[model samples]
Target: MSNQHRMHGVFAVPTTPYNADGTQNLEQLAAGVEHALDTGIGGILCLGATGEALALSRDERESQVRAVVEAAAGRAPVVVGCMAYAPAEMSELIAEAAALGADAAMITPPFYGGLPPEAAIAALRIVMAASELPVMVYNNPHSTGTDLQPSHLVELLDTGSFWSVKETSGAATRVRELRAALGDEVEVFIGADGIALEGFSQGASGWVAASAWLLPEQCQRLWDLSRDGRWGEAIELWKGLGAALGQIEDNPAFISLIKAALSRRGAEQGPVRPPLPSVDTESVDALLSTIDGIEGRALHV
Candidate 1:
C-alpha cells in the first residue's frame, strides 16, 4: 500500500548456480548476491526468468531464496518470484518466501494459454489475498501467453495490494502508456535490458534485469544518469554498451550469456541446468570482446 517497501533503481536478477552434480550451489549463489549488493544494486530478485525459476524444484527454490536473503543481509529488498498456474500453489510459494524472510513476491499471471484476461486478474487477486508480503505484478507476455493489459493492471493495482509492476513487453511505449494510465498509482520497472534507456526516458522507476547482475556498476551508472536528468550523457553511455546489451536482449542464449559474462567477470556462475545448454565458447568470447570494448575492466574479455 505504502511506498515504504517499493524498490527503485536496479534490482539484479542473479542466475542460480549449480554444482557439477546438478545440485544447487547455494554458496556460489550467495557469493554472487553479495557481490551484486556490494555494487549497490537497489534489490535482489530470486527465482526470476534469468534465474530459471521454472527449472528449479520447490525445495531448490526455498534454498535459493534463503541464500539470497541471507546474502543481501537487509542491505536491500529480496523479492522472490512466485509463479504458478494455480492460485493456491502461488499462495503456497508466497508463504514459503515469507517464511524465508523475503521482502516481497513477484508474480506473473498463470502461463496456461487461452486463459482470459479476467482469469489472470482474478488469479492474481486471489493470490494477493493470501500473500503475507507485498506483490509485484510481473507482466512478461513473451514467456507467459497471458498479457495483463493496462486496463487490467489499473483494476488490480488500484486495489493497493500491489507494490509495483515489471513491464517486459519489450516495447518501450508500454512504459509511457502505463505511466499515462496509472500516473504514479503503481511503480513500473523495466524488465527488458535492451530498452532500459528508453524505458527510463519514459519514466520507468527501476529495472529488473539479468544484465544488471552481470554488469552492476555500469547498469547502475545508466540508472543514475537517467535519474539525474542527464539525457545526453545517458545516451552516450548506453551507446557505448549497445553491442553487449543487444546480445543480452536478442540472443537465444539470454541466460547463458549472462552466466558466461558473470564468470568471465570472475564471479564464477557455473553451467546452466538441463534443457538449456551453455553458450558456445565462440559466442562467449565474442560477447566478452564487446563487453571489454566498453572501457571497463570489470568485465574482462
Candidate 2:
C-alpha cells in the first residue's frame, strides 16, 4: 500500500528505551520497530509522548528517529513526533526526520507558555514552511496545556498546513465534531488509547496508540473489527482489555509501564529516563495479570 493509505491504521507509538546509565538504547529502539512490524502494525511513530520525546536531548531524539527509520526500512511508514516549544526547533527536527526517511511529522502547539490559538497557528505555519514532509497536528491538551479546539483545528486546516490531526482530547465526540467541520478534507486520528473504539466509531480515520507497543495483535484486531463494521466484536475486545488499556490513563508514568510490559514479553526495553521512575513491582504485576487475562480470552475465542 502507498504510505498515504498506510497512514490510516494502527500507528504504534513505541517507548524510547534507555540504558541503566541513562543513555539511549538504540538497539532496543530498533528491536521495538521490528517487533511492531512483525505483529503487522500499519505504521510506527517514534519520539512521541509514549516515546518520551521531551526528556531526550536533541541528539538523542535524532538518533532514535534514525534508528526507527532504519529498522523499519520501508516496511511501514515511520512518523517522528516533533514536540519542540519553538517553530524553528520543530522545523529542524522535522527536517532531520525527513532526511532520515520519516514518512511524516507529528507536531503539537507551542507549549510551556500555553500559546493562544493564533500563536499556535503561526508556529505550525513556520514548521510547515520549513519542512517538505506532510505534518500531522497533534492536539494533546493534557500535556501541552493548549487545547486546539475544533475551531482552532478548522483554522489550521484552512491554512492547508496539515495533512491530519491527532485528537488526544480524550473525547469521542470530538471525532464527530471534527468530521462535521473538516468533512473528509483532513484525516482524523484518535490519539487517546482509552477512546480508540469510540473515536473510530465516530469516524476517526486511524489511531495513534501507545498500547500497541506491547499489545500489538490485540490493538490490530480492535482496529480491524472497528473498520470492518463489527462494532459488537470490537467493543467486546475493548472491554476484555480494559485493565491493560487503563494503565495509560491511570498512571502518569505510562512510559514506565510500557517498558515494564515489554520486558515481561521478553523485549529488552531498558529503564525510563530520569525524572520518571521505574514501574513498581505491584504495578508490573497488575499489568502482567491484565495481559494474561487478555491472552486467555484470545485462546478461548
Error of 1 at 134 (Å): 1.2
User: Where does model 2 exceed 4 Å of error?
Assistant: 1-6, 158-161
For candidate 1, the lDDT comes to 0.83
Residues 1-301 of candidate 2: C-alpha lDDT, one tens digit per residue: 1245336889999888778787878898788888888988989888885456888888887788888989999989888898788888888888888888889999888777577877787778777766677788888887777788888777665444467889988764899999898777678998888888889889999988888988889999999999999989988999877568886557777888888878877886787877876678788888888889899999998
Backbone clash pairs for candidate 2 read none
Can you tell me which runs of candidate 1 are displaced by over 4 Å?
A: 296-301
Evaluate residue 43 in candidate 1 and report its C-alpha lDDT on the 0 to 100 scale. 93
Mind giving the per-residue lDDT tens digits that candidate 1 earns over 30-71? 888887888878999889854588899888888889889998
Q: List the candidates' TM-scores in order.
A: 0.94, 0.94
